[model samples]
Target chain A: MSKEYVLKEVEFWDGAMASSQALRQAEVDIMAAYPITPSTPIIQNYADYLSNGYVDGEYIRTESEHAAMSACVAASAAGARVTTATSSQGFALMIEVLYQASGMRLPVVLNVANRALAAPLNVNGDHSDLYLGRDAGWINLCTFNQQEVYDMTLMSFKIGEHKNVRLPVMVHQDGFICSHTAQNVAPLQDDVARKFVGDFEAVDSLLDFARPVTYGAQTEEDWHFEHKAKQHKAIMDSINVIEDTFEEFEKLTGRKYNAVESYMMEDAEIAIVALGTTIESSIEAARQLREEGIKVGIVAPRVFRPFPYDKIADALKNVKAIGILDRSSPGGALGMLFNEVTAAIYTNDTKPVINNYIYGLGGRDTTIADLKQIAKEIQANADAGKLTTPVQQFSGLRGPKLSFFDMESSK
Target chain B: MLEIRWHSRAGQGAVTGAKGLGDIVSDTGKQVQAFAFYGSAKRGAAMSAYNRIDDKPILNHEKFMIPDYVLVLDPALAFIGNITANEKEDTKYIITTHLSKKELLEKLPNLDEKRVYTLDCMKISQETIGRAIPNTPMLGALMKVSGMFEIDYFKNAIIKVLSKFPQKIVDANLKAIQRAYEEVV
Candidate 1:
């Protein structure tokens, strides 16, 4: 029996708590998770809800991250609404099962509070975990703050559980920056959110013994290629379902979301494409730089999986030059976001001079001063009709200047 | 928008103080964001928390550069980090210190006396809560300096948040807040 929760019209919550509240509202069947920072609060709050009788769900305390995800797969295949959360190394440990969940077309929603991987051992916000899960075949969504963390999570269930798109979804937010930061969030009424997410339709659940169906079947070379193509079609078909869900959510809450969120891009000659909280800061930077006669704008991809290439390309179709900020550390190469964005716009007629800046790895701060300098460089490159310096360099690097991968050839 | 920064040690209730202030302000239909900047600090190590309040939605989630006010929960941290890095023209500093305003100016030699407010928050916390957590008194002092919210609102909010605690603890915090509210100058 699901107990009704008395949710405030508006409340103050951090990102993790907001996500946990969304999961509570969804009335998930099972949450099998191993707590990891800064995503620990997502699971902790859910566990608290369970203990306090606020939510009706089973809270599984697994031995490790791998076991947590392994339990989620089992629960999902058995026709249960499954969800879990992890970050950094925990996410890396669950990487193997992530593919299994998607390959089996299980609609398990995972919340990932993105954190930097350990090498010299650091626990801070970055996109290394996000990039690591890029090609895992799950539908990926990005949130800027607490509000999106709530909204995107509710929508992830609908998008993943749709009949046309039976794929797991991963909802991500910056680790400590978004997870630990307390802010205002206007949440939907419990019944309104419930109606919007609707009911889950389990297709061929393992528990339906009357029509016995087997999951995780071995399709050798005979049918392997056909099965893989069908999986790819499902991911590609999710785009329409995602759009429809966003529309339905907006109609209910009056908050609209897009696959690609653009700020001041109209008539902009220079633009910066970034993700997560950086988009909000870049809006401030664009406002400040505009006063100094710089035609700067900002572009952010709200959806990373089934990558929003067409929307991203269209947003930058008119800009003269663009700068792509990637938070993940590039191991002797360019950042993953830079590579994806370049591929997105390579065939476009705009052919803007693109520059890739690998930044904020290991949680280094990105200041407005750095953005202003980048704005100036993009403006200069636009006016000169060419890149002024190296196409790719590490923004906010502490040590001596060193650009990566064919950067020397540019000089 | 009014942005404020708080400086304190790791175990000194900085995050809680900022979050408390956020909850109070947001209760009055205003928007608020409270966050901290730390590099895995241990107990007694220096850390900072930031608060941003505005009538509209807060878009930028970055750290503050030119905050309207700076509240120092520890007098010792003033000498280590750039506590006074960026401030508006008439930025206020509500600090916890044993020294008088005149003596604090003499020690710093750089701080202006007009905008500096000091109170013995440690003594207040010790006498009331039986600890060195000066955040309550500091908030009390901040309410007086900024005048963003009424003193009663803060007192009531504190009481409400600490409602689950023992009445003695709640009463002591209320007394600490009241004493600092009247005592800071």
Candidate 2:
């Protein structure tokens, strides 16, 4: 029996609550999850909804994240709409199974409250876990705030479960910052949201005995390369479906989303390329800089997995200099975002002076002041029409200024 | 933008108070953000929660702030929590303590006497709500000090926010809010 839940036009919700509510409205068949910091509330709230009769879904309390993802994979393969949430170390544990889920073409949804990986065992927001899973064959979607967390969670199911894209999707939100912070979120009515998400369409379901289909068949070297190539093509081709889904959602909700979100980029001279919650903060900084007559803007990849290289290049085409901010530690080289953005721009005619900024690791606060300083540095580069600072620098890191790759010295 | 900070112990309801305020503020079509820093701290450990209210969508996600108002929910935290950190020149402090404003300012000589407001939220919650949870009473005091909303309007909004609780508990919280609203100085 479903309980009477009066839907509000809008409500105050944290990122966790927003995502959990979306999961509930999607009416997922199974949620197998192991609790982790920051992400615990998402599954916890879903479990509460399940017990209270608001959602007719099964909540499996697995012992570990590995077991949780394993359960999700099993359920998804068995033709159940499956989803779960995890962060940090738990995400690392689930990495082994993430590839399996995608390789088997199971459209499972994983909500990752992005956190820093362990060394001193920190439980704070960063992109270390997000960066770690970039190559796991899951379509990654990044969110800027609580509202996007809800919006993207709903869209993830539609995009991943599309017939053309039968692959898993990961929605990333910065842990603590977005997950724990309460803010205003306008959610779709239950009936409308349900209609938008639609029902789970099972293809080659394991439960269908009459059609009995085999999954996870070992291809070995004979057909493995071809299989992998097909998987890559599916991921690349899913971009169209993702765009259409975004458009449909916009039509229903009037909130538009783009493959690459550009803010104040019209005729801008310098730009900050970033992701997650930092994008909003950088936009605020850029707005303040604009008051001082500085032509600074922000560009962020809302869809990170298929990597919208063309959109990113077009967004930054008019800028004279760019700063790519990555919130994860780059063990020995330039940041992942820096590498990707530069690769995208390398094919373009307008070659801007690009610099990498590694920042906000292990939950360090990325303040408006720090972002303003970054924009000023980019402006300096734009004025000089060449690289003025090191090719890469650390933002908000303590102690003496740490930087690398002095192009001048190399030259 | 209106920024506020709360200093309290982990068990105390600073996070809840901040979120409750956010809920009430958001109802008026204003953008609000409420969050806390939880560094794996246990109950009885010191913690802080924060709120930001603005007319436009808040684009800043940084925890750093020069708070316009500082709320100290635990009496002991008044002395040790560095409640004045990053406070603006016109920042108002609403503290929960049995001590009078003069006495609190005397003990913490650095505080501006004109800006300090004190009330016994712990006692009010104990007497009215039948518990020592001072967070609701602190909200009442903040309502009186900040005057961001009228007493009756704020209480009704909070009543809606606490609709999940039993009628008896909700009534008690309303009384606690009313008492602190009148008694805080």
Candidate 3:
């Protein structure tokens, strides 16, 4: 831990509203938004700040989320720092432009209040939206609470606009859990935050009349593959840029953040890997289980996009068995997070038996009691010296038992 | 650590009450988290807010499954919403009801006789503020029961947070809080 870097009195703020404050401090030149549940407060607060002279910018209320993202792409290409907020179906509506923002190499910041995608038409927190943008070629950051929401929103502008990593970034927080929950937030002075993010530098902007640049050009079969390959390289190589930004932020703010956060992992025999607010409860569960003589630990990947494979594998190297918790609905296949984690640790020397457990989709509550029960079950598997049940299961889902990948059937 | 669950209607100020109490607790340099359940954001619908106060940072963001204190801003919600689900046996119920402690205990089967406390917060709020919100009075009753803050501390906090409002509104809320503090039994 570094020395506390607070320069003013701490204020209580919820995650959504604080996100707006961070965006205001960044002094974004343009924001195009369409309001959506749990995420509307972000843009709403920013609009209020702009109108109250707290920020100098343009807030455009668009007709639809698609138009909102489209305007962001246009403003960003025209050499303006741009930002927006969306959730659930709103994110789904912007899917096409999400690719455009990344493909055109525009560094637009998006605050995604993670919410459940609608088929049953429910509005609540889930990873469906976060997962939807995973393959859209944007840098993804996960925050557990209000502090991270403020800190990471500032850090995102730095990482996404870095010359080496000019890709849009999505800072995700669980819907109601973080977005609506109020907590203490120590905000940096406006000038300090502005200096930390630094001045916006446009690489190849449409505003440069002398040096004409063409955007949205169709890269047919001849160059599409090569263009996409470079974009892939840029995102894959952003890990270094992200770490450097984290280091600089820590130096300035005295708050230390890691790519993969470990909780009681040292000498842990049973470890659970999760994301978002679920990690919060899992940590509490880990502490209680430790007192009960159960060697339980938790691993959470703070940076979800470039999916910190090596860091997470190292964190769980000593654990005997791993429980990978995925919050998104898995219709016919294994959970998205489970697939990525298993691939990350596939080549580890210890080769711990990792299982997939889907929980908390559609805002179903995942409590400490549920986590404790999972820890006990995974502990039982480790003691048996072999696989005890199916490798994949839906945890905490009400109704009859549902399990995938039966070990016996696979054999 | 203290965990509380507040029950009220959507138009009521349970969410605001949770934040107001959090403001006072955090003023004492303790960590606090305040949040409400999102159920369509419709008016007059049953809604709930939660608070967690501790000397250390709070980690659990899930809704309260077992709260130490349950403050009911609307007495009818106690039975209508099953507000006492998954509560501790010793959980204290500070309710805004015209019913006496004996009468409230008789009505709310889930509440223990010794732990239940009643206050006519709605009546006080209507008399002072001319609104039936009852959230400010409930906060006062909570402050009295939990001893979480001095009465003066909350009074100053109320003034600070509502400094932008009209004097009558502020004065009425302050009066409601004082009356609830004196009348909770």
Candidate 4:
């Protein structure tokens, strides 16, 4: 039984504090983490809770993110509920172990403070790290603000630990924008939150003396392909469990969520598709534009993994044009969001004119004014019934209007 | 909607002050947001903190703002901090200075003297809290200028916020707050 704690009806908290509180309430068995910018506070607060007798858990001070993930894997395999947090470079270091954790079907919940990959050396918000892990075989949940960060983190444990979906989960929030911004948050009572998360049930525990289990076995070209196929199937099938979990969470806390969220799209002709904190700003721009008779809308994927193709397509099928905003640099190609969204809606009878927008790299501010401009440009494309600008453009970049790919020429 | 920007050094508790103000404002069942721009800044490095308060939930996450109130916690920042950047025509300034309002206005020719308020927060905090931390005094001055909360009600709420500290320290902070609240002009 968990101890009961009195909580205010509402309290002010940053995304990091909210995440740490959720982790504490879940009564995690262990947390092994390496301190990194923006994300350090999540584990730091959890460690403080452990020291102050508020939580009963082991806090491992790992030398590096690689060691941290390795420790989580070992502990989770030993039948303990494990978790951790990291950011840009640290997440880059853990990429190798991330595959191992998911391949082993260990349900370790990882909180990511999404940041830009360093080259010029910046510690700011971007989607580079989050996009880097899209192929790592984890259920990725994207949050728009501090409240969602808290809710998604608490629910990640339940979703990942479900018997039908025994896979790792990643909850991502934009660094600084969500992680460092303080706002009002309503939290559940400790006992209620604990009961909602439930206990971790170990299946085929390595520590079980009566029944032994083997992990990390090497199956060469003979069986590796079959194992990967099964993993993919599990991820695809886990959507059922995810929906059920979201429904149950809504019942408990009246805050409804969906795999794909659409705002003001009932009769919209132009839409902006984005993720992370940009969703909120885009929504604000959409509202402002609607008042000016611009018929704009916003679409975002709450579940970044498994793509939520059907929901996204249904929400966006009616729009005439779309501006897909990608915060990560595409290196030398159209943005990843552009590629995925195009694929999702390509099968529709009437496809919307989709354009790629690469913006907000390395923590550059994405203002409502900028989003409004993107929406207006998309509106122009909708009215013209053709490509009005390049297929890909860089927004908010200083000096020079850099763009590429001419749709008319390609056609 | 009301927006506020604080100009201060990193170690002077500007971030703490912003969060504290958010905490206080949130109790009224309104929406509030507080954040700071921390770009590898060391202690004593100049930085700014911001706040947004409104009746409806605030969804804007951009750092750019046309602030309604500009607060200067360090006197030097009044002249060198670009305090007037993105300020509105009616934006009010609350600055910490040992000099009179007229004296400080002469130093900052671009500012409208009528919209500026000044107090010696350093002197107030040192006399009452036995230190030079000016964040609490600045909050006191804000309370006095904005009239957001009655002095007694604000003090009681702040006491709860500072409950984790020793009673002696809490009492000293109250004195600093009260002194600045009465002294700012």
Which candidate tops lDDT? 2
Error of 2 at A83 (Å): 0.2
lDDT of 4 by residue, A1-411 (tens): 334456788889999999999999999999999999989899999998888887888999999999999999999999999999999999999999999999999999999999999998889999999999999999999999999999999999999999998999999999999999999899998988999999889977999989999989999999999999999999998888888989999999999999999988898999999999999999888888989999998899999987898888888899899999999999899999999888888888877788999999999999999999999999998998777999999999899999998766634
Worst 10 residues of 1 chain A by lDDT: A402-411
Question: Candidate 3's residue-wise lDDT over A243-323, tens digit each?
Answer: 999999999989888999898888899999989989988999888899999999899999998889999878988888888
Please give the distance, in angstroms, between residue A339's alpha carbon in candidate 2 and its true position after superposition: 0.1
Q: By lDDT, highest first, what's the ranking?
A: 2, 4, 3, 1
Each prediction's TM-score versus the true structure: 0.96, 0.99, 0.97, 0.99
Local error of candidate 1 at residue A80 (angstroms)? 1.0
Q: Candidate 3, fnat value? A: 0.62
- Tens digit per residue, CA lDDT, model 1, B18-94: 98888788888999999998677889988889999999888766665577888899988766757778876788888
- Model 3 steric clash pairs: none
DockQ of each: 0.64, 0.89, 0.73, 0.87
By DockQ, is 2 or 3 better?
Answer: 2
Error of 1 at A273 (Å): 0.6
Tens digits of per-residue lDDT for model 2, A60-122:
989999999999999999999999999999999999999999999899999999999999789
TM-score of model 3 (first chain only): 0.97
Q: Write the per-residue lDDT of candidate 1 for residues A191-277, one digit (tens) a residue.
A: 888888887778888899999998889989999899889988899889999999999889888999998888899879999988888
Query: What digit string (tens of lDDT, one per residue) describes model 4 on residues B10-91?
Result: 9888999999989989998999999999789999999999999999999999999999889899989998899999988889
Give the TM-score of chain A in candidate 2: 0.99
Q: Interface RMSDs of all predictions?
A: 1.4, 0.6, 1.1, 0.6
In the predicted model 1, the residue pairs found to clash are: none
